[model samples]
Target: MLIEHLTMEEFAAGLERTRTVLVPFGSTEEHGSHLPLDTDTMQAIDVGRALARQRPIFIAPPVHYGVCRSTFDHPGTLSISTETLKALTIDIVAALYRQGLRYFILLSGHAGGTHMATLTDAGEVLLQRYPELRIAVVSEYQLAAESGRELIETAGDSHAGEIETSRIMHARPELVKGTAPAEYPAFPKGLLVRDKRRFWPGGVWGDPGKASAEKGARIEALVVRELRTLVEQLEAWQDS
Candidate 1:
């Protein structure tokens, strides 16, 4: 259930009984021209809610800002430093840890390289400090990318591509405008860091033209199935 929905007493009781919490790590960033800026936050919350339905887990309020240094060239993108994101994540998780929540499943909808690394570093530090804590940083994009490799029609998805657009279409169709054909820009070899707009001039890395509600539904189903399996494994680990 959503933690905000619970009273103080109910929240305390839930912590006493349930050992796990789902945190949605989202971002307020540019999602091309068609999608909304809060796409990442919306998708992450959707996944968190779905997971909450399958088991007894408290859904925490989502983190709306993320590390988006690459997308700085975009007008609507708001990004935090990697250090800031890492520290924020650690602090939030630490607060929950103090509340006796042992398991934290961070559902990240934004998949920036630096963002993921910061989160990974934060998870490692948290684990080091609290040996009993079990933290899992799961990315919705990564899950879909790995599992839907064959299913996604786009060659590669950098921002508001088919995978993202399709998911948004399925979840919130009103947010999507008409899509257009897109092409990938050639990147400098071994370029460590650069503005995303250089490669994605239109703020889209994948072919949004191929996206459809049916495809989005199929992708969500697959992701939810995989996440369910992960939850089951976590439950078994807790029992053991």
Candidate 2:
């Protein structure tokens, strides 16, 4: 069930049954030229809803802002500071912690390294504060990347790539325009530049030409399965 849609009485009843909550995070950032800016958010919410069908958990309202460094100059990309994202995550989880929820899965659709790191840091902070808390910071992208490695046709498919495009195609086809040409950014390794878009003009990191709804459905199912397994393990955690 989604926490945002639950009434106080319904929330209380849910708490009596389960303390597990899945908090999905995504970015209001660009996803190449074809896909919607909220692609990450949409995919995260999709996974949460899919997982909920097979398990008992509350889905928190997704965090739509993330610290987007590479896509900062891209159109429709709205980024918050790294500190802000971290603090927001900590505050949200802290609020949930006080509400009798103990198990948390911080699932982010935006899998940027910095964004994931900030979430991991927040999970650590929550754990430090509430030792009984059972938390996991993860991204369905991690599972999709691993599980769909063989199914994907594109090399180094990451952002706005075959996999992501396919997932969006399966989940929200109406939001997609025609597919954009495959592109790989040439950002300087171990260096920072102000003109991020110049190095990656198209804002695509992999081939979108190979994306298909069939592949997307399979990948999404795989990710949901892996997440279910993760939740089962988290639920079995016992204080030592």
Clashes of 1: 0
Local distance difference test, each candidate: 0.84, 0.91
Identify the runs in model 1 with alpha carbons over 4 angstroms from their true place.
192-196, 238-240
Best by lDDT: 2
On a 0 to 100 scale, what is the lDDT of residue 65 in model 2? 91
| lDDT per residue (tens digit) for residues 95-125 in model 2 | 9989999999999999999999999988888
Q: Tens digit of lDDT per residue, candidate 1, span 33-88?
A: 89999999998888778867777888999999999866767889899998899889
The 10 consecutive residues of candidate 1 with the worst lDDT sum are 231-240
TM-score for each predicted model, relative to the true structure: 0.92, 0.98
